[model samples]
Target: MTLTLYTNPQSRGRIARWMVEETGAPYEAVILDYSTTMKDEGYRAINPMLKVPAIRHDDRIVTECAAICAYLAEAFPEAELDPRPGELADYYRWLFFAAGPLEQAVTNASMGVTPNENQQRMVGYGDFARVIDVLEQAVGRAPYIAGDRFTAADVYVGSGVMWYTQFGLVEKRPVFLDYIARLQERPAYRRAAEKDDAALAAAASGDQGG
Candidate 1:
């Protein structure tokens, strides 16, 4: 149990897999069933919220997807998955911004609640439209989220963007489309996806042989 990842390939756990793939680190995966996995007393101890995609890095347990991605990237520096020192500031800024505000806006939009102008003033993300505009401006200006290079920040933001784009949950703005194209083309991402896909296929076959 060097690093234990409790995940469901179909959930936010995929984000953790992306990070782990970027790190090029060795870890074990424990696929869980949707019906009973979360309720098992042992899994609850790993994440009180009974969330998927929890990680155990040796003795430290990290539950949230973003925290797990950020921590793993730094913990395995040889992987070079984090922003360079100069770009680190913007990296942190957009990473959490996307994780927080962008997520809220997406979820809110799915529920059919467009914010009023007055409510927009108080909400950090403003509205779904504004969130798209802001992210478009930043990503369009730089090749990657953190200036010139890909980082752990991209891993999180990219995952959110990619999913939203695929599901039509977010608008297919040029910036969003281009960003996902680039992220998906990365060798590391491709490799990780292949592994996860295989694991999922195997699990479906009732083998879980990996």
Candidate 2:
């Protein structure tokens, strides 16, 4: 079955679009308006949360950017975006870490909401500083998040790094700068960016016309 991606250009769906590009998958992009289309019943059925970036492949539906990235990588092994069985520990580890701890840390810090000491213990990310340090060290240790070879983990983690750095939510350490440089060099990344940018422009034009 042909894949269908329900997405908004400015949303987290861009990450999924990038993953699809990396997979070299032939997919249909359904661009939805954030305010109206996302709340529609049809889209909501695919994602109960009424979120963008949901994908339907055959009879299966997948939501969440990280999950979609992993799914596409495994689904299209000819793309070789995932690590082999023996080398999957780092792949799963960093991917989940980015989706969980790293994401939460950056979100909380961006909103100026630091957890108290007790709250920190209970929080999955511990503290923002610790999360930052661990992620920085992990990326610095290797060329890619899952080690030497680029994997789906990099798609998720690299998106986080790019967004965080762009928003000034995370410090632009040499490790992050170098990693992003490598990611930007990929043709898939550039194609994804251009596609989303054009979508965004079209949406803006529509708004103006209305």
Candidate 3:
């Protein structure tokens, strides 16, 4: 598989980076800085929407973080992080739930635009309280999202929780705090983070010389 990932370490693409590391394949990774137009006409040819975490898998180009992570795990099932047929429902459910409610709530919280509890139906995530309640139910039940075993869902939710916490979009609840800490202990996450840090450091040193 001549896979090439176009990503930014600071973006949601970090989840994709961990997936690629888990893939254990000889894939090329291109890191884009904030100054670059990742969605510019040139890069947009790979993904017209111009999003990071896009990958060229042979002839199949894929975009979006969770999509890329889900796809790669299946494409490299020897890696074993892939979801099975029976887990399909919950896998897609939690991932989609995260993509929708998690983003809306987190963005609203960051912008201080969360809806009042009474007028929640007027908002997308129905206020941060509702969002938190829903997550507490789903997450608190699991050895993983699909239950009993780890799957690609963890990668997506783990990243979402980690990011929202970083942005102070979510309250520091024990469950989320513990989840993030546990997720960070994954070897694949360590590998990608180490690579990203080293690359960032080298780039910083280069700018100093210039």
**Candidate 1's residue-wise lDDT over 1-210, tens digit each?**
388888887789888888888888788888887788777998989888887999898999998878887898888989887778899898899889888999989999999988899999786788898888888887787889988888998989999989988899987888888989999998888887887788889878988566
Error of 1 at 202 (Å): 2.9
Candidate 3 regions exceeding 4 Å error are 37-40, 116-119, 207-210
Clashing pairs in 3: none
> Per-residue lDDT for 28-127 in model 3, tens only?
8887655666757778798887678799999999998878878988898898887788888888888888988878787877787857767687666777
Q: What is candidate 2's lDDT per residue for 1-210, written digit by digit as tens?
A: 789988888899989999999999899899987788889898889999998899999899999999999999989999999888765999999899999998988889989999999999888888999999999998998899888888888989999999999989998999999999999899999999998898888887875221
Report the Cα lDDT for candidate 1.
0.86
Cα error, residue 99 of model 2, in Å, equals 0.7
lDDT computed for candidate 2: 0.90
Which sections of candidate 2 miss by over 4 Å? 207-210
| TM of each candidate vs. truth | 0.93, 0.96, 0.88
Candidate ranking (lDDT, best to worst): 2, 1, 3
Report the candidate with higher TM-score, 1 versus 2.
2
Instruction: Using lDDT as the measure, name the better of candidate 2 and candidate 3.
Output: 2
